[model samples]
Target: MAGDSSFDQDKNKLAEYETSSSGSYKSSRGCFNSKTGELMGRNFFSWIKLLSFFFIFCGVMSTLFGLCMGIFFQTLDYYIPKLKIEDSMIGSNPGLGYRPAGGLGFKTINGDYKGLSIYSSLIWFRHGGDGNFDRLRENLDKFLEEYEPGFFANQGASLTKCDFESKPKLTDESCEFNKEWLSDQGADIKCISAEHYGYYYGKPCILIKLNRIYDWFPDPYDINEVRNHSTMPLSLKNDIEKIYEEKCDDDPNKYCPYLNMVWLHCDGEDDPDKENLGLVSYTPFRGFPGYFFPYRNQRGYLSPVVMVQLKNPTPAVLMNLECTAWARNIRHNRLKREGLVHFELLMD
Candidate 1:
């Protein structure tokens, strides 16, 4: 019985020694040991750590590539001339807009014109009623505030006194037509307020003005060619000649000889007579002249204001108007150009 117990103890000690030796060999040789499963667990954790590092490295590289690409495109856009159709240039073309546009006191006379037609139909009218004149004044005041803040102030026109709590009144001095210089040259400042000009002739009108762009100058050669081109209609040619005779007196040095003109055309395909009348008559009978002062980086220059009073038109007639600033560098191609503002007038 003693010998049996001693033999059992010796067998247990030998088994423990074999197990320890197997574990040591597995660890030193970097081999899997199925009994413990420790080497398998270590290898699984090592693979997870390696995959995590690879994913993190890929994420970092992708972010850096996106940032570099964005900067490159932005830089390229800045240096390139914008194509007007694509609108992909650094500075978008300055747009022309109307005042008292889609606001209180002005209501659309007809249903909204949609799609490509809306761009040509900017104005709608209703019969003159109470508050019309006041609303007109208010709208004009807002327009000047937005587009020409310093215009009246620069022209020595003063605002009416008002309490700090109340809105200030715009005076006649500030809003009235005071083109004394043009008047002195015998140019008619025909488009003042409807009341001042006798409203019986037409409806009270809103002012149509161009947004300011600094340092813009018309190309003189282009202006002369367009004005005197043989393709110009006979009536239009006569009108141009008459304007030069009356305003500039055939003198190149006098009052803006190369006036930047706005031409109005009927949008419909069937109006051949209206289209044939040529560019001169399109000048708003009371608004922007065929030409404007050539702005040559003049300091503190104020653009001229164009007030348009439409004569009673056949109801629901939409007029397509385009104001083009004729400069040599200002091209008018559909793909790439600046220097034109398009709008539509609808009379009801």
Candidate 2:
């Protein structure tokens, strides 16, 4: 009987221990735990405390970064850059660029940001491809529209009527560039915007302009030196001579009208390409007038443009056309496409 009594007491103690254990386990998973975590076996209060610290830390870091950026920006001017010339990355070399542009500001690679396409360098299309030439003409018109008269007049900036002789430069002023200068008062129809920029006839027009350098001016080619140059292209030489004669020829003693021009010349890159590239023409003296330079980051500065018309590019041939800007200061590196632009032209 005593043994039976002892066994019953032991079984009761075991039952009591099991009930306490079950209650503790349920409480640990529900809202609190005593083993280690204070709540839900995951330390809910501790996680909340850590997350609050992280949030505050992120906020403080973001605030500091924004404050630093704001302070840096406060030291800058909107109109002019802090660095100039040798101190600047451009280092006085103005790169040549062309328009009738394509494949710009467009790309997709798993939807991340990247730069322009290599195909943008080529102007290629079939003769009768649907909407091809129309798109090209539209591009020209849109690009040239910025250069038209009164385009920059009401833009809250002063316009100076610049000339190579009298007004050769600007002081906080931008030149009012005229469309007449682009086509020589409608003499060059091949490059005129109304001619569809030569796209209607499958002979396209390209406009070249210098990428601006702040307060930078071209050191022009000497008139007397270029007068009887041996190595210079014939067409550019003739154009320079004509301008010099008309403007500064009469004055024998006083050399007032310097040949202040950033001259432009275009041809095929190679012999076979040149053979395929037919007669080319540049209107408005084949150069950007030096008076239009020394870009000062004026609100409405219009960099002078040189219009290049490929009158008869060979059909069904991929010809590499190169246009270079000539000046004493401009550096040329064909491999780098510096001081010049290289593009492919094709017609079919």
Candidate 3:
């Protein structure tokens, strides 16, 4: 009986050992599964990071390529001159009076006469009855009383209604309107008169003149660093020296800034030479809001003319309006048609 009891106890011991081994197997299996999940998560994150990096690289390359293409196209268009009709000559200054230096004038030898039609041309005009001061005062008074003040205030724009009431003093000395603040708006100093016109006898005439000395040949470079290197590309820093050597530099006078000036004049019978004409300035002849003038000429005619000059004289045409053969011929031909007074363009 004692031997049987001992065998049963050994069997019980073997069963306990088996149970402990099963628990350890489960714990090991769980640890292995957890490790596998962590590895998978790490792989997912790494793949996402790699994909984002690839997209970023592609975007950067695309931006660079786009910029390069834009620059190349711009350079091509700029270097190559487009064929444009010589409408500039036809649309230049009010026809009459004197031609300013480095100026262009438009003369209408034959055309239907209408003040509204003349206004349609690119010319600047301030009526002859009052000068800039009086006009400004009149306009300011009307503007203040009109809807402009309320409209500006509602839009959060700040402006003094009274500042321009009498004629604002010149804030900048370089501005012509400022220089003539106290005196007649036409006097003092301002931009060179590119064109002016008045009537002599009964013949309506137009004249173009330069208001300032060498106003046409203005500097192109806005910055000191890039001023001398206008022809060279800004991107190709290393190759700039070579580029400049290959391409000719910009000429201030030769650059035609898509500007044209013309003048128109009409006077009553009496003596044509005794007419006093007003000057007009027309800018950006094409599209909307064309032409503006603030002063009158010595002739007794209303002068509506266009004034054109380049902000940057790079493409070279603004220097001397006479430099252009077609332009010069047009002026000469138009002026000669007038019976009493004829214009001969002589370079000074």
Candidate 4:
């Protein structure tokens, strides 16, 4: 046959090359299933772009944790340390006043009103009148001409002259004004004059002091555990056992006893009435006393004047005074109370 017709034309070209490779492998698996559905739609937009970058990284870490707790409670009062009491550290409970005399607004002396009015130095003088004592003596004479070398040496006073009649000559043994050990304890040195006992007794003689604190101490075993605790005050524990039997010979650390105790209470007296004339009488003569010698930063260390003499005050009437300083760990009723010093006197 012609070689059996060339083997049936090579078996019809091997069945037309296997049906053209089975339609080219089903069009290359439909172009690899459209590139595997475009790589599963780019892995579902990369999981919604990684969940929108994890909610923008938790909204920038919760806005930086609420701005660092609002800047740490807004500087927590210049870093926590106001009227500390409770485990004794003693050093920042100072501030007590009364040096205005008649300078902070000089309200009147010869004409009688003697200062304090602008609604009584803005309620700090407490209260008096005459329609605000000419604006409380022109804002207390512009605040005593801006604290004039007063406010306890403008608040630092490590003793800058309270000399009281010359007494400083000790070659050595560290003697910076001992006035002969405070005149060997009879104590009456005297030399803190801002001269304003209402210019010598026409009434308002307020010169109370104490407002310098640099190296404060007061913790001789917390003042004998606050004078043998029991909530003290049996007349202040017999005045701290008569200041440890006449100045610490009975040894409560040999002396540092009267840690600050001044108490005047005109309208709140337990027994005031010092010769009532519309009542107002005081007498803490010459500086607070008991025993407090350890100033340390002693720049000639001298801060012991507390004078208070307001007798016969009743010209226009408006007393209500209160000065308290008693200390156990120096707290004075905390904060803006700084251990008390309210005022209000109207001796016309």
Candidate 5:
């Protein structure tokens, strides 16, 4: 009987060992192990160590990236462009634009002119008392507001009065455009804003300007260049020469920037347009001043404006008016409208 009790005792101990071993094995594979009290195969301490390592690694990498970016940006000027001239998106050639062009103008090109989105090149309005000059003049007023004298002055930004004689020389003075510059004592005086930009006189005024190119300045035409230019209009050439003779013809090399302006020429787009379009006049100046450029993106720098007056255009006729800004650096590409702008003009 004592031998039988010993065997039973040993068998009971063996059975107890097997049950405990099974439980240990299951716990090792579960959410918490009974022996180590670990969660998801890792103890709390081990998890904390791993998370700390990852967090430090990410923080260091992010800090290094941000520091590098800050260093890179610190080298650049906010006001000046990093890329300019040929490297600029505007290229070496500046583009041409017109005023009262913020939104699409009423058009009749077999398409509705209602959508506000787009190039906005059309300028259709009535010329007489019963016409739609109010809309055109209002648009002009808004457009010219920035050109007013106190605009940049009030903002603490300034421009310089630059001349065309020297190349790429920008001064510290603000070249503010005054509305009084457009006033004339003669019959052509109708070009003033008080006269509703001459829309009331059937002599509407058009404002022309060059699209700004960063650090890009215009190289004005010399007497030889203008006289020998292959495609320049005869009338434009003559006008330029007359101005040159009066202003700076004494010195062959030195040209007055105010007088030595980038010449502007406007006429009919086609033979029919030329025939229907009447006499036109340029107010203040014929072209944008050479001194206004190499645009440093100066605050309150007003681009020079040329006011054109269309006098006695054939009533009730649709005319395709094409205007071009001339300079040595400005390439004339009709297809791309580079250095040029085209607009439809009609008066009832």
Candidate 6:
């Protein structure tokens, strides 16, 4: 009987140990599942972070390439300036207007050719009318006294009357004007058309009278936009014509022809000897880019410019002037426009 009791006790202890072991195993399994879920969540976040970094890297690379292309094209456009004479801003204004004369504006960042004098000193003059060798010398003299030593003056068309009359032949009106102007000056300034009648440098010369200079070169402070923008003289076009006719009738000996029509330039230009050429109005001024940028427009801030007006700034009336003494020859004059003569400077 004692042995049977001992066996029963042993069986009970074994059952208790088995139950405890089972519970412990269940708890361990639950803990393992929770750990696995946390690991999965962390892996998802890592994948998301990796994808975001990849996208950011691609965006940065694309921006860099775009910037590089922009710079490359901008630089290329500046150096390779393709100039078209017909589309030039300077020569675009037609027969009778105050078109901007195109020349180099020397900015004095550190050297000479600065301020108002620089602007005023830089100008080019055109030569027109039939060649009366005597009158030619007078014009040359005037140019020397008024302009820089390096100024270039080119002779356009033979000294003559209206070259572009409605019928294209030189008109009687032009002839009469030249005769009168020469008579008034007591010097010959005749103009007779040659086989060809055109601009001096593949461009047309503005053929306004000497008396009309004030209209174009007015004070910048003047609020008159018409005077500022006008290329025509200040009087009625027909009224002035009548006056000219009346003057011719009254004093036959005191008449001057009107050759005040500027030409529109185009291709097929011949460069005058640089030594003889006065100014560079061959090409037009294309502002900052391919836009019309007038210096002192009523709209925006006026761009600083150099204006050089030569009004009777001569040494003496009876002085001998060398043709090349005070003029600059650009690309054309450096090789062409090189000739010498005596001239004077006289303008009111």
Higher-lDDT candidate of 4 and 6: 4
Q: Cα RMSD to native, each candidate?
A: 14.4, 8.3, 24.7, 23.4, 9.2, 22.9
**lDDT string, candidate 2, 95-203, tens digits:** 8888776733354678642444656787766654442566566667787787766676574356777776655554787776776666645444467767767776766
Question: If both were scored by lDDT, which would come out higher, candidate 2 or candidate 3?
Answer: 2
Q: What tens digits encode model 1's per-residue C-alpha lDDT throughout 84-110?
A: 323433242333445445433223457
- Candidate 2 C-alpha error for residue 224, in Å: 3.4
lDDT (10s digit) by residue, model 6, range 35-90: 23423234557768988999999999999999999987776544223432245433
The deviation in Å at residue 182 for candidate 2 is 2.5
Candidate 5 global lDDT: 0.75
Off by over 4 Å in 4: 1-62, 65-67, 70-96, 99-201, 212-282, 289-348
Report model 1's TM-score to 2 decimal places: 0.43
Question: What tens-digit string does per-residue lDDT give for candidate 4 at 1-348?
Answer: 999999998899547545664454345532322423423234567768888999999999999999998987786665234444333354466656654534234346576555443334212232233233343334334433423343334233343322212243222111222322211122122212322223233334354556555445443233566567673345445545554465444555543433333332223222332223342333332234423333443333355544444545545444445555555545555247575565555454
User: Candidate 2, which ten residues in sequence have the lowest lDDT sum?
Assistant: 126-135
Off by over 4 Å in 6: 1-86, 89-91, 94-118, 121-139, 142-166, 169-183, 186-348
Q: Which candidate model has the greater TM-score, 1 or 2?
A: 2
Q: List the candidates' TM-scores in order.
A: 0.43, 0.78, 0.19, 0.23, 0.73, 0.18
For candidate 1, the 10 contiguous residues with the lowest summed lDDT are 180-189
Q: Against the correct fold, how does model 2 do in TM-score? A: 0.78
Q: How far out, in Å, is residue 347 in model 5?
A: 2.0
Q: Model 1: runs farther than 4 Å from truth?
A: 1-95, 103-121, 130-137, 145-190, 193-206, 221-224, 227-237, 247-301, 333-338
Arranged by TM-score with the best first, the candidates are 2, 5, 1, 4, 3, 6
Better of 4 and 5 by TM-score: 5
Between prediction 3 and prediction 5, the one with superior TM-score is: 5
Q: For model 1, which pairs clash?
A: 120-344, 259-291, 260-291, 260-292, 261-290
Better structure of 3 and 4 per lDDT: 4
What does candidate 1 score in Cα RMSD to the true structure?
Answer: 14.4
Q: Say what the RMSD of model 3 is.
A: 24.7
